[model samples]
Target: MFEKILIANRGEIACRIIRTARRMGIKTVAVFSDADANARHVRLADEAVHIGPAPARDSYLAIENIIAAAKRTDAQAIHPGYGFLSENEAFCRACAEAGIVFIGPPVEAIRAMGSKSEAKKLMEAAGVPLTPGYHGDDQSPERLLKEADAIGYPVLIKAAAGGGGKGMRRVDTREDFLAELASCQREALSAFGDAHVLIERYVVRPRHVEVQVFGDTHGTCVHLFERDCSVQRRHQKVLEEAPAPGLTGKRRGEMGRAALEAARAIKYVGAGTVEFILAPDGAFYFMEMNTRLQVEHPVTEMITGLDLVEWQLRVAAGEPLPLKQDQLAFRGHALEARIYAEDPSKGFLPSIGKLLFLSMPADGAHVRVDAGVDEGDVISPHYDPMIAKLIVWDETREKALSRMRAALADFQIAGVASNIGFLSRLVACGAFAQANLDTALIERESAVLFPPEAPPPDEVFFLAALTQILGEQGVKGCGRHDGWRLNGAFSRAMAFRCGEFENTVEATYLVEIYRFALGKRSVSARGRLTGKMIAAEFDGQHVQAVVVAACGALNIFLDGAAHKLEKLDPLDVAAEGGSGHGGLLAPMPGRIITLLVEPGEKVEKGAPLLILEAMKMEHKLTAPATGAVRAFYCVIDDQVAEGAELIDFEPETI
Candidate 1:
C-alpha cells in the first residue's frame, strides 16, 4: 500500500476515503477550500492542506492546486472521491505528470466516457445496448429541435458531461424545447463547464439500476451485483438499494456481464459504476458510466462485505483483483437514504445554516451512518448540501426497509431544514414497500409523498411554549417557586410565528402538567424535561421528543417531523405581517444567474422573473401576481443572501 494518499475532494466522500486509507495503514492528506477549513474531513485526516477559496473552481476543481498539494505533502497517490475533479480527465493526467498515482481509472477512460454523446457512440461500437436517441455533435438549437422531433415528443435533453441529475431536463412538447434547452445548457456549463447536450428518448416508467464493477491493472475485472436507484426527485436519486428487487438471476448476470464489458471496452481500472434504465418488460438500456466511486456504494458494500475504497487503493497499487467473479456473493439486502439539508416542502431547495442540534440513530451491525457534518457545523452554500447517508441492512428487503424507516425517524437536525420526515413517509408508503419503483415514483406518488401542509398539533405548540418558559426560567428551578402561586400553577403567554402565520399561545404550568390554548383550541398535557428531551402525555397518548432552543426559535422533533416555532413578540409579529409587499425575494442563498424582467417591465403572474443558481441547481423566481417591475435590487452574477429582496414590483390594478 502507498505510504500517503491525498484525498482530492471534500465532505463525506473525502472523510470516507480517509477512514479506509487510515485502516490500511496509510496516511491520508485532505485538501480543503476556505469554506471547509474546519470541516470534519480536515479534522479526520492525518494532515490537511489549504487548497484555495470557497468556490469549487478556485479549490476542489483546480487540478493544479490539488496536484501541488499532493506533491508538497509527498503523497504517493491522489484519490478523487467521486465529485469535483473525480471524473475530470485533466486531473488524472495532471496526477500522472506530477508522478503521483491516481487512484482511479486511466485518463483515456475518463475522457472517452466523459461526454454522453461520444460515450454512446463508443458503447454502441462495443456492442452495449443503448436507447434510441440522437447522440450527434450538432450543437445548434435548430438541429437539436429537429433531432427531438425526429426522436419524438417527451424527450430528455441531457448534458453531454453531466451526472447527479444536474444539466438534465425533460421536454414534453416542441413549444417548450428551446426554453428547456437553454436552461439545460446554462446548468451544464455551470456544473461541468460543458454546454453541449444530447437528445434522448425519455423513458417514462424506467427504473434506474446500476452495476458495481471493479477493474485492476493486472487485467482482471469483476461485477458486484446491482443497485436500484429508482426513487428520485429532480432527476437525482433520493433512495437506493442493493441487488435490485425483483430482478431475476439470469437478468442480473446479464447486466453484470454487460457492465464488465463496458469496463473492458474502456480499459477502465479501479471502482466504477455502469448505470442503466430498466423497463417494465425486463429490458434494460445503457444510461451512462460513472468513472469513480458512487455515492450509493455503501449499499453495495453492505451486501457484498467488500470495501470498494480499499479495492481502489489496492488496484491503483497494481494489486490483482481481490476476488474473482465466482468467489463473490451478496450477503443481504441493504438500503441507503441520502440525508440532505433541503426542504422537500419548499420544492427541495437547499437550506444553509448551522446545525443547532444533530442526533442520529445508533449504529450497529445492521445499521450505519456515513455523515459529513456534526452538531454546530455550518452548512454553507458553497457546495453540495448533503448532510449524511443513512444505510441499513437486513436479511431481506422488507426488514431492511423497515429498519430504514425506523432509522430515518430517529435521525434529527435543527437550525436548518431537512428531508428526514419526507424520506420517512416515502419509505413507509405502500408502493415503495411493494418495490414498484421508477424514476417517476416520486411524481406519481406526489399526493401521498407531499401531504397537505398542516400546522403541528396544538399540543406541540403548547409544549413549545412550556419549554420556552421553562428554559428561560431554568427547567431545574421551574419546579421551585419561580412562577408558581399558592395554587401551584402559573400563567404565561407565548407568541410564535410558523412560516408566514402567527399564533399566540396561553398556558398555565404546574409541576408536571400544563394546560394551553392556541387559536381557540385548548388542550392539557403532562410533560417533563429530562436533559433536552421532553416526555409528554397528551390525549391519553405518551410521546417523547427532542427539543432545541436556538436563534429565537424552539425547534422540536416529534414523530420524525421537525417543527420550528419562532418566539416573537406582538410587535415583531405585526412587523413581519406587514413586511410583505409583492417583492421578489431570493428563496435561498445563491448567485443571480439571469434576470428575465428589467425595471418597469410588465410581467404576467407566474412569469419567470429571475433565475437563481444554488446548490448546483437553477431555481426560477416567478412573479407572485401580474405586476410591473418598479425597481431592481440585484442583477446577473450578484450573490445574495436568502430572503434578500431581488425585485420590487408594483401590483397591477384589476
Candidate 2:
C-alpha cells in the first residue's frame, strides 16, 4: 500500500478519503486554495499545502499545483476525490507520467466513458442496453435540432462531458429547443470547456438508479448492488437509498449484469458507477457513468458492509479482486440524505458562513456519516455547500425512511440557511414513501416542497414582540403568549436554556420560546408554535422556525429539536436590527465583490447597484426605483458582514 496519498479535492469527499486513509494507517496530504485555508478538509489531513487562490480554475483544477503538492508531500498517490480533477483523463495521464498512482479508474476508462456521446456509441458497440438518442459529433445547432425533432418534442440536452446538473437542460417543445440548446452549450463550455451536447428521449418521471461496480488490476469486476436516487431537485439527487424499493428480482439481476458489462467494455479498473434511468414499464436505459467515487456511495456501502474507498486503494495497489459477483450479498435497506447549506425558498442558492452550532447524530453499527466538517468549521463560498451526508440502515425500506426522517429532525445547524426543513418533509411525504415518483416530482411540485413562509415582514414584527417581552420579563416571557380562558384558568411552564443555563417559565400551550438568558438579569422570548414547528423570533428581526420537530412529537412535545437562540441574541444587544433603507442588501454574512455605483449616480428602477458574490455565486442587489445613489458604504472586494450597507438611494424627482 502507498504510504502517503494526496487528496486533490476539497470539502466532505476529501475529508472522507483522509478518514479511511487514517484508519488504514496511511498518511494523507491535503491541497487547498486561499479561500480554503481554514476549511475542514485541510485541518483533518496529516499535511496541507496552499495551491492557489479561490477560483477553481486557479486552484482545484490546476493540475500542475496538484502534482507539485503531491511531490512536496512525498505522496505516492493522488486521490482525486469526486469533483475537480477526479474524472479528467489528462490529469490521470499526467499522474501516470509522474510515477504517482491515481487512486481511481485507469486513464483509459476515464477517456472512454468521459464523453456521454462517445460512451453511448461504445456501449451500443459493446451490446449493452442503450437509450435512443443522437450521440453524433455534429456541432451544428441546426443539425442537433433536426435530430431532436426526429426523436420527439421532449428530449434531454446533456453535455457530452457534464455531471451534477451543470450542463443539462430538458426541452418540452420544438419552439424552446433552440434557446435551451444554446444555454446548455454555453454552460457546458464555461463549466467543462466542452460545448458538445447529445439528445436523449426524456423519460417521464424517471427514477435514477445506478449499479456500483468495482474492478481490480487482476481483471475481475463485481457489483455491490444498486442505489435508487430518484428523490431530487434541479436534477441533483437529494435522497438516495440502496436496493431500490420496488425493484423486482429479475430487474435487479438485469441492472447488475448491464453494469458489469459496461465496465468490461472499457476494461475499467477501480470503483465506478453506471447510471440508468428506470422507467414505469420496468425497462431501463443507459445514462453516463461516473468515473470516480459517487457522493451517494455510502448507501451502497451500508447495504453491502464494504468500504469502497478501501477497495479503491486495494485495487490501485495491484491487489486482486477480493470478492466475487456471487459472493456479494445485500441485506436490508439503507438511505442517505445530502444535507446542504442552501435556502430552499430562495431557489436553493448555496449558503456559507461559520457553523455557530452543530450536533451530529451518533453513528452506531448501522449508521454512518461521510462528513468532513466540525462544529466550528467555516463553510466558505470556495467549495460545494454540502454540510454532511447522514445515512441510516435497517432491515426494511419503511424502517429506513422513518429512521431518515427522525435523523433529519435531530440534525442541527445554525448561523446560515439550510434545507433541513425541505429534506425532512421530502422523505416523509407519501410520494417519496410510496417510491413511485421520479425526476419531475420536485419540479411538478416545487411550490409544495417550499411553500412560502408567512410574509417576512409579519414574521419580523412577531420576532420584535418576542424580543421585547424577553427583555422585560426576564425568564418568564411566557405570560405575554399565554391567554386566560373565559373562566380564567390553565397555564404551563417551559424550561428554556442558554447553553449550560436553564430556567422554567409559566405559559399556555403553543407559545414557542426562542431563547432565554440569565446574566445579571434574565430574558425570554417566544413565537407562535404550530404544525410540527415552533415558529420563533430569530436574531431579534427575522421570524423563522429554529427547530423542526418530529410530526409525532406534536402529540407529545416539549421543545422542538431545531434551536433559535443564537440567531436571536446578538453579543451586543444594543446593536441588534440597526437601520436599513428597505431595499434588499447583504443581510449579514458575505462580501461585496464590487460596488456597481457611486453616490449621486442615477439608476433605473430595479437596476443593478452592486454585485455581491456569496456562496460562490454573484447576486445583484438592485435599486428599488429610478433614484440616485445618495450614499455608498462599501468598496470593491470589501469583506462586509451580513447587514452591512452597500448602497443607499434617494427617490427620483418627477
Candidate 3:
C-alpha cells in the first residue's frame, strides 16, 4: 500500500479518494487551483499544494505541476480521480517515467480505449456486440457525410475521444448532417483537442447500462455487476442504479461476461466501466469504455458491499482481486441521484454562487452523501457543478425509489439554483417508479418534471409576509404591544422579487390573526414565529415553513422548493426590471471558446453566434432574431462575467 498518494482532481471525487485513502491508513495529498484554495477537498487532505490559476489548463491539467506536487509531497502514487487527467494516456506514461505509480489502468489500456471509434473496432474484433457505425480513420467531412448516409438518418456523430456527452450530436436527416458535424467536431477539438469522430446509428428508446470492472496486476479481472443510467439529460446521466431494474438474471450474467471479456481483451488493470446501450428488445450494443472510476460508483458499492476506491488502491498496489466472480453477491437495490448546482427551469444551465444554506438527508448505512462542498462553499464556474451524490439502498427497488424521493425532498440548498425539486418530481413520477426508463425520459416527461411554479402558491406568499412581519418586530413570539393596531387591521405591503418573478404581498395583522393577499386572492391564517420557523393554519390545515435569511435574500423552504424572496419598496418598482437592450449577454460566467459571427454579419433567428465554455460544458449562444451583428465585445478565449454583453446587434430598420 502507498504511504502517500496525491489526488489529481478536485471536488467530490477528490474528497471521495481522500476518504478511502485515510481509512486505509495512507496519507493523502490534494492539489488545488486558485479557485479551489479553500475547497472542501483541500481541507480534508493531509497536505495541500497550490498548483496554478483557476483554469483547468493552467492547473488541474498541467501535468508538470501535478507531477511536481506529487514529488514534492513524496507521494508514492497519484490517483487521477475520474476527470482532469484520469484517462489521459500521456499522463499515465509520464507518471511511469517519473517512477510514481498511476492509480488507474495501464497506459496501453487507456490508449486502446481512449478513442471511441477505435474501441468499437476493438470490441467488434473481440466478439462484443457492436452497433452499425463507421469507425474508419478518414478525416474528410465528405467522407463522414457519406458514412452518415450509409448508416441512415438519425445517426449519432460522436467525438472519437469524447466522454460525458460533450462532443456528441444526433443528426436526424442528411440535410442537417454537415452543420451538426461541424459543431460536433468543433466541440471535440475544443474539449479533447481531437477533431476525429465516428458515426453510429442512434438507438431509439435506449437504456444506458454500464458494467463496473476491475483488474489487478496479477492479471485477474472481474465485473462488479452493472448500473442502469438511463435517466439522463443532454446525454449525461442524471441518476443511476445498480442491478439494472428490468434485466433478468440470465441477461445480467451475459452482460457481465461480455464486460469482463472487454476488460481482459486489453489486459486492463484498475477500475474501469464498460458502457452499453440496451435496446427495448433486450439487445445491447457496446458503447465506449471509461478508463477510470465512474461518478455513479456509489450505487455499485451500496449493492455489492464493496469499496471500489479501496479496490483500486489494492489493485494499484500489486494486490490480486479482492473477490472472485463466485464470491461477489449483490444484496439489494441501490440508487444514486446526482445533485447539481443547476436550474432545470433555465434549460438546466449550470448555476454558480455561494451555498448560503446547505442541508442534506442524514447519512447512515442505507443513506450516503459523497460531497465535496460545505455550507459556505462557493460553486465556481471553473469545473463541474455537481454538488453531491445522494445514494440510497434498500431491500427492494420499490423501497429504494421511495427512499430516494424522500431523500431528495430533504436535500436543501440555497443561494445557487439547484435541480433538487426537479429530481424529486422525477423520482416520484409513475413512469420512473415503474422503471420504464430511457435516455429521453427527462424530455418525455418534461411538462410534469418542470411544472411552472411561478406566482408561487398562496401559502408561499403568506409565509413570506409572515416572515417580514415577524422579522420587523425583532421578536419570535407575539407580545401585547407588537406594533399591530389593536383596534383595527394593520396592513403593510411588501415588494419582493424571486429571480424573474416579482409580486406584491400585503399582510394585515391584528395580534396573532393575519390575512395575506397577493394581487386579489387572500388567505386567512393564524400564524406564530418560533426562531426561523413559522407555524400557520389556513383552511383548517396546518402548515409550517422554514425561512433562512442570508445575503439580503429570504429563502423560504416549503414543499421541497426554496422560494427566494428579496424585499423591495413599492416605489422601487421602476428599477425592478432592467431596460430591454438589444444585445447578447453571457448567460453565465465562462470563457468564450468560439466566435461564429463577425461584426456586420447578417444572421437569422436562432443562428449559432458564439460558444461559451463553463462548468466543463460548451454552451452555444445564438442570435435572438434576424439581425446584423453591430459589434463584438468578446473574442475567443476571453473570460467574461455573468451577464457581460458579448455581442451588439444593429437596430431593426422598420
Candidate 4:
C-alpha cells in the first residue's frame, strides 16, 4: 500500500478521496486553485499546495504544476479524482516517467478508449454490440453530409474526444445537419482541442446503463454490477440508481460479462466503466468507456459496501483484485441526486453568489451527503456549479425513493438558486415513481416537474412576517415593548414585497396569539423561532419551516419549496433598473463567443443575436421584438458580468 498520495482535483470528489485515504491510514495531499484557497478539501487534507489561478486551464489542467506538487509533497501516488486530469493520457504517462503511480487505468487503456471513434472500433472488434453509425476518419463536410443522408434524419453528431454532454448535437432533419455539425465542431475544438466528430443513428426511447468493472496488475478483472442513469437533462445525468430498477437477472449477468470482456480487451487496470445504450427492445449497444471513476460511482459503492477509492489504491500498488465475481455480493437499492446551484425556472442557468446559509440532511445509515462548500463559501463562475450529491439507500427501490423525497425536503439553501425543488418534484412524479424511465424522462414529465408559477400561499407570507417580527423582538434595546400594552391590544403594520407585488399585514396582539389580517382574509397565528427554524400554527393548522435573512430579503423554506420576500421600508426610496429601451442584458456572467447580428442590422423577432458561453454551455441571446441593432455593448471574447447590457436595439413601430 502507498504511504502517501496527492489528489489532483477539487470540490466534492477531492473531499471524498481524502476521507477514504484517511481511513486507510494514508496521508493525503490536496491541490487547489486561487478560487479554492480556503475550500473544504484544502482544510481536510493533511497538506495543501497552491497550483495556479482560478481558471482550470491555468491551474487544474496544468499537468506540470500537479506533477511538481506531488513530488514536493513526497507523494508516492497521484489520484486524479474524476475530472480535470483524471482521463488525460499525457498525465498518466507523466506520472510513470516521474516515478509516481497514477491511480487509474494504464495509458494504453486510456488511449484505446480516449477517442469515441477509436473506442467504437475496439468494441466492434471485441464483439461488443454497437449502434449503427459512421466512425470514419473523413473530415470533409461533403462526406459527413453524405453519411448523414444515408443514416436518415435525426442523427446524433458527437465529438470524437468529448464527454459530459459537450460537443454533441441531435439534428432532426437534413436541412439542419451542416449547421449543427459546425456548432458541434466549434465546441469540440474549444473543449477538447479535437474537432473530429462521428455521426450515430439517434436512438429513440433509450436508457443509459453502465457496468462498473475493476482490474489489477496481476491479470485479474471483475465486475461490480451496473447503474441506471436514464434520468437526464440535456444528455447529462440528474438521477442515478444501482441494480437498475427494471433489469432482469439474466440481462444483468449478460451486461456484466460484456463489461468484463471490454476491460480484458484493452488489458485494462484499475477502475473503469463501460457505458451502454439500452433500447426499448432489450437490445443494448456500446456507447463509450469512461477511463476513470464516474461521478455517479457512489451508488455502486452504497450497494456493494466497498470503498472503490481504496480498491484503486490497492490496484495501483500492484495488488491482486480484492474479490472475484463469485465473491462479490451486493444488496438493497441506492439512489443519488446531484444538487446544483442553478435555477430550474430560468432554463437551468448557473447561479453564482455567497452561500449565506446552507443546511443539508443529517448523514446517517440511510443517507449520505458529499459536499464541497461551506456556509460562507462562494460559488464562483470559474468552475462547475454543483452543490453536492445526496445519496440514500434502502431495502427496496420503493423505499429508497421515499427516503430520497424526505431528504430533499430537509435541505435548505439561501443566497443562490438551486435545483432542490425541481429534484423534489421529479422524484415524486408518477412516471418516475413507477420506474418508467428513459433518456427523455425529464422532457416527458415536464408538466409535472415544472408547473406553472403561482402566487405563494398565504402561509408563506405569514411565516415570513412572523419570523421577521420574532427576530426583531429578540434584539436587546432595539425592540418595541409597546406592543405589550396592558390597557389595550397593541396594533402594528408590516409591509413586504414579492417581486413586483406588495402587501401589508395588520397585526393585533392578544392574549397568547396574534390576529392578523391581509386584504379580505383573517387568521390567528402563533409561532416559536428556534435558531432559524420555526414551528408555527395558524387557524388550527400546524407547520414547520426554516427562514433565512440574507441579500436584503427574507428567504422562507417550507415543504421543499423556497420563497423570497423582501421587507419594505417606508422611509427609503430607491429605484431598480427596469426595461432599458429594448436593450438585452447578459443573463449571467460569461464570455461572448459570437455575435450573429452586427450593429445597424434589422432582424425579425426571435432572431439570434449573439451566443454567450457560461458554465461550459452555449446560450443564444435573441431579439425580443422586430428591431434593428443600434449598438453592441460587448464584442466577441469579452467577459461580461450579470445584467451587463449586451446589445441596444430600437423596436419597429407596430
> Who wins the TM-score comparison?
4
After TM-score superposition, the amount by which residue 521's alpha carbon in candidate 2 deviates from its true location, in angstroms, is: 25
| Poorly placed runs, candidate 4 (over 4 Å) | 479-490, 499-502, 569-580, 600-607, 624-629, 649-654
Residue-level lDDT tens digits of model 4 in 1-654: 999999999999999999899999999999999999999999999999999999898899999999999999999999999877899999999999999999999999999999999999999999999989999999888999999999987889999999888889989999999988988898888777789999999899889999999999999999999999999886778999998989999999999999999999999999999999999989999999998999999999999999899999999999898898899988999999999999887778889999999999999989999998888998998888998999999999999999999999988899999999999999999999999989989889989988987678788888877887678778889857426885889877888887556778888877778888888999999989999889999998999998888978989988778888998875566887655458789988888988998799999998999989887777788888997999999998999999999999888776
TM-score each candidate: 0.94, 0.77, 0.93, 0.96
| Candidates' C-alpha lDDT | 0.89, 0.77, 0.89, 0.91
The deviation in Å at residue 90 for candidate 1 is 1.1
Give the TM-score (vs. native) of candidate 2.
0.77
The residue pairs found clashing in candidate 1 are none
Ranking 1 against 2 by TM-score, winner:
1
Scored by Cα lDDT, where does model 3 land?
Answer: 0.89
> Residues 511-622, candidate 3, lDDT per residue (tens digit)?
5677778877877767678877788887568998778888888888997777888887887536464433388899899889889878899988888888888776778888
Candidate 2 residues 204-273, lDDT tens each?
A: 8788999999988888999899999888776778888998888999999999999988999999999999
Ranking by lDDT: 4, 1, 3, 2
Q: Tell me the deviation in Å of residue 112 in model 2.
A: 0.5
For model 2, state the Cα shift of residue 4 in Å: 1.0
